[model samples]
Target: MVTKLPLAVLLSASMLLSGCTVVDLDENGQPILPKDPAAKASFSSQTPQQIAQENWDSRVLKGAQDRALTWNDMKNKSTALKAETSSSVFVKATGTVTAVSDDAERERLLTVTINGESVPVAIGPVIRSNAIRDAAGFKFEEFTNQVQFARLTKALNQQNVQQLPKIDGSWVGKPVQLTLAVTLQPQRIEDAVAVVIKQEQP
Candidate 1:
């Protein structure tokens, strides 16, 4: 049925559509602004892409800080090998390395310190994150805080950028699963493995 619309409704819709039109300073009057100059200044900002990039970088840095781990945290927790042998032998290192030859490798070198009498040795393929948990219902992500990362940075020589392996997002809180690809001497590997097993026991 034909009906007459109220003049007020029609005028309001027209005003809204007109407001969206691009106003040219050369043609239209100086850009209409709020009573306060500061409020108006903030409106003329960067494009959407620039804003998104800024937000992404901020989140990435925060995530890196959140997931960062310390040397001791990585040592006591992520080491595949750790044991209180006859001698208090402890090997804690964090970094990435590339094999040079059958018997040689280049270590970017961050930090390494041992308390007991032992040869200073290092191996790579080391990637760690405090984002795991254990069967005992222990959460490891708690160890990835800033305090831990600072300690790790002080103790181990790590690369400028440490890349962690992709873990199933679902398994984060279920069990502690850390993957370390170390190229240790056979004997050292055996020792480290023994230590790690002992530590994990119970």
Candidate 2:
């Protein structure tokens, strides 16, 4: 014999199984929901360049400033500073290029001087790191390896390089403003590589 259930019990069971009590359907049978205003606003406000610049300014620039050191400071207190900070230090310097390395196949290292102390800036061949991204408050676990990080670095490097003068004989004496993310290892400041290099407009 079949047992009949009450209307209220059947409706409750159906609602529980469906996982939704109310579903507003449009004329076309699709869900009728309001557009997300916040999503729309975000989409309209953030351009690719603006987003990238924000990341650069907030993460890369701020990260550098957190433990900033001058060329002379790094030279004299490399060991002490590295031991104290135990992370990459950002170096900001305005200097003229005294020499440019002859290596064309690999990264181009520009030897510049701030108060007569030499600092090398690396340009190209490889721009890979999540240091800036991490500094921008992004977690590495969100990505699969360095692919996204590499893309960010590559775009940044390209934008910076485009604004810089060619690394040739002519660039040897030109003034440049460099902001670098330098690894604090082996107690050497000259081994620092520039993450951003901008030529001072004369």
Best prediction by lDDT: 2
Span of 10 residues, lowest total lDDT, candidate 1: 193-202
Instruction: Estimate candidate 1's alpha-carbon lDDT, on a 0 to 1 scale.
Output: 0.30
Model 2 segments more than 4 A misplaced: 1-54, 61-68, 72-77, 81-86, 102-104, 128-165, 195-202
Model 1: residues with Cα > 4 Å off, grouped in runs:
1-60, 79-111, 114-202
The estimated TM-scores of all candidates read: 0.18, 0.50
**Model 2 TM-score (2 dp):** 0.50
Residue 127 miss distance in model 2 (angstroms): 4.0
TM-score of 1: 0.18
Instruction: Evaluate residue 86 in candidate 1 and report its C-alpha lDDT on the 0 to 100 scale.
Output: 19
lDDT of 2 at 80: 68
Error of 1 at 94 (Å): 12
lDDT of 1 by residue, 102-165 (tens): 2233431112122222222222334232211111112223233445433332222222122222
